[model samples]
Target: MSSISNRIEQISSSKPGAKDYINYLHSLSAAADLISYAKAIIQIPDGAIVARPVLAEFVSYTKGLADAREEVLIATLDVLKEKTIIFEEQEFLAREALAEVYEQKNEFTKAARVLQGMRLDSGQQHITDDQKVAVYVRIVRMLLEDEDDAGAETYLNKCALLIHKCNDPAQKVHFKLSQARIFDTRRKFLDATRKYYEMSLEEAVDADDRLQCLLAASKTAILSPAGPLRQRVLTALYKDERSVQLPTFKVLEQLYENRILDQEDVKQFAEMLEPHQLALMGDGVTVLHRAVLEHNLLAISRVFSCISFPRVAALLGMELTQAEDTIANMIIQGRLSGRIDQVSGFVYFDSEKSNLNVRQKALVRLDEVAERIAATSRDVRIY
Candidate 1:
């Protein structure tokens, strides 16, 4: 091993030809000689400008070797980083490699710190915007993986500013996806849903990504506050012919249409969700199911001026008491403009009277205007 190490040292100092370096690496691999290979890597003179590429290649080759020790690789990277002024690009590459090594070892914080340090250090130089965006995207991903949404969000904004610098559509999509995920993790569902829906419409988004965007938008839309906006989003998703076959899409459509969702429908739809999806919107499905039932009840109220509690229960497929409580809550919440007669057990839909009141108010205003016009005419006389 010492003789092999001596020969590697001599070759590295002499800055041998590329073929010679290749032969040396091949012999090292053939013998599974990790120590000598590491020595050969470290012995490549730092100031050998002509041989820097070969040195980097050797370092990368050692990193890929199964027998290479973590400590040795990290130490080699540190050595390379120390010579950044001499080989700036290679130093950057070395930092990236070191961070990856830390990541492979499950030292995520350490990995992120390394990358963050690289970003700060490179800020002093003429780093390309694409490179900066790349680093920011990576840090954001790492921070998100570490469950630091706030930290991820900070970097995510920085990435957004530099996103235009990225010419690669896929990379831009990746950053946008990451930003959407940050919004999701932070519970900004509406914003996330909007972004996901937008991504679904992007022509650059591949079929798989488009499908995923639609699914995510559907899930987030369910959690969004009930309003015309949510309804509009659901309508768009339902009209998306590509998603017509998805089970979640079917569920969303049924809920939006105020159709009663039975247990079997929910069960089958639940099967299509990933574990994380189930966790994120498990309660959302329940709420949506309840909303559907209530919406159906509202429709019933609109159609029938007065309906017996039992009839309401029958229409909603619920027990009489559950129906009563649901309607009572709706009335309390002002969602249903109606009154429930507890003694008679009837729900009187006052929507018609509510409309009539508006008409009556309009007539009263018209009569007052006519009276005012007559009085003004009488006072004006022949003028």
Candidate 2:
């Protein structure tokens, strides 16, 4: 220990460069003398040029030390920042290390602030776009972890711009996935679903990533507010060949076909979901429960012109009042085109008229085609 302290003192007194400082720090780390090294680094004069790299190296070396003190690490970083001109890249690295330590210590706001101070342009293109992307991603994650969705989104946009500058396909996909997650966090399910679905189609994305994206898209589509837009998105996903073999495909198909989703089916599907997927989609039990109700309502709209409230309740496995409330909510949301008659205790489906109108329009189009064909035949005969 005396020898190690002597070596550190000699290195610090000599005004070492970055390489020399790093080498000495590695020796201390290898000797398991990080405490002595940390004390020596902190004692270096604040304006000493050697202090920059020494403090940066101190931050890195002490980072993984289970017993390393936070104050020592932070004080080292503060000195590194003071000598920014000589530090340059070392300053960035030191700040990043400091931020990471803050995060590990659960000081998320401090972590975010440390990273936010790192200006990518300071390196003047010396820093790779990938590095810029990485920093922005960290900041976004920290902000998000701190429950600052709006702040995370601001960094998300910045990260996006840097992503385009990078040549790494993986980095681009990473940014996209992060962006989709932000949308998900914001409860913009449609936007999140669209992003995921689009990513699933990208040939550049790896198969595993594509599969995950498709699964996310399908789940978010299910969670999207029930509407024609939701139906269109689900239909597209249902027809996607890549999704056909995934376990979630069946759930999507069942929902798209307006088939009642049974508890057993949902349990089977839930078992297939990844832990993150299940968490992101919320409680699988409740999700399936709601899906069953939605499926029954949709099926009723498509099949039955009129049904007694008791029958509706039986089909949905809910009581009369519960069924009435669910159906009424669906109706008000424009998910179910129907009305309930309190006096008659009957629910009438009005979507059938719309279906009839669609068929009539198709018939009129066919008649127009027939008339055009006849006109063309007469013209040929006259010629």
Candidate 3:
């Protein structure tokens, strides 16, 4: 640390006068060890002031130093921006710090306006490449926060261009990830999936940032459109993996119910689901479809736990009367082995059975009625 500090001092000393010294300090202050740089910055006095105008500049430059250390940077900037420390140079530095500090504080539009106004002034031409990148990133974040996705995309593209020009690999990766997110938000599915997939692979191979890489890969594969191409992509993704995280049972059921996946796939998907997810699948199906399946006595009891009779009837393309008669006949014929709720009209199935003469006879008659309806339907061809 001392060697680096001495080297910075040597470089700055070669350039005569205050402006060069301030520029040197600004550059050094953006180093990884911001606290040491900050302490070094505070040691430089400008004219009669206890600290130099560059001190605020340094603090504002490193405002995003790790979360815990950010407070010191923020506090330092606040002190420099105070009204009592007034000089043309000092005021300019203070305004620059104000824009940066406000951006870190997420006062985005205010920061943008400050930066925009500053750009109109000749003083803004002195800003560095790093400063422009930081400012534009804040603008992108602000636009995303406001749900102005197009604006966010424009700003992020600008940041990407700047970072690319600087040849900063780390920031390039970050900018690409941000671009992927923007595409995701815009529902540019193929673009998002491809970019995220590439980013994840690069991050993984470089072993630079594992968690972010894995997250990118997960999101990429999770939302990718399914077909032959998607299957090939998944095959590559899982080739060396020990296990894969499948989509939720609800999602699978929806795909199947909508004919996105076939019945065999739906059954296989259901078998893979956790019990709770399986239970939720009933509600995931169309109301009329679920009701029809339940009325035919084909639906599972676990599925019925999540659905009501009216919803089931709606699924089956039947009226409440039809549903009630179907369930009643099941009970009467000793097939349901359940009790009927008189109030809500819900049928509660149990393992119990009833032996009766009158109900059995009535159920036989009910079956005849159902067969008659089936025959009548078969006879008609409205189409």
Name the top TM-score candidate: 2
Clashing pairs for predicted structure model 2, backbone only: none
lDDT of 2 by residue, 181-232 (tens): 8887776778989999989988998889789899889877876666556788
Rank by TM-score, descending?
A: 2, 1, 3
The per-residue C-alpha lDDT of model 2 at residue 56 equals 59
Name the lDDT value of residue 108 in candidate 3. Answer: 68
Clashing pairs in 3: 287-315, 288-314, 288-315, 288-316, 289-315, 291-312, 292-316
Please list the residue runs of candidate 1 whose C-alpha ends up more than 4 Å from where it truly belongs after superposition. Answer: 1-5, 12-23, 30-51, 67-72, 84-88, 98-114, 120-126, 142-148, 274-383
Every model's TM-score? 0.67, 0.71, 0.40
The sequence of per-residue lDDT tens digits that candidate 3 reaches over residues 204-272 is: 246445434444443444344433233344454454242133333333233223223334544554454
Candidate 3 local distance difference test against the native: 0.51
CA lDDT of each prediction against the hidden true structure: 0.69, 0.72, 0.51
Q: Report RMSD (Å) for each prediction in the order shown.
A: 8.3, 6.1, 17.1
Position 293, candidate 3: lDDT:
41
Candidate 1 residue-wise lDDT, 1-383, digit = tens: 57776776787677567656657765665323644554455456543554466556765766656535456556655665655555556556667876787778777777777787664444445787787888888888877777778888888888888798788777787798887788767656677888898888888999887888888887777655443355667787788887776658667877577565565776776566434334534333444455556667756765789999999888777778878877887777655667888999998888645733344568888999999999998899563
Candidate order, lDDT descending = 2, 1, 3
Off by over 4 Å in 3: 1-96, 99-131, 203-209, 240-383
What is candidate 1's TM-score against the reference? 0.67
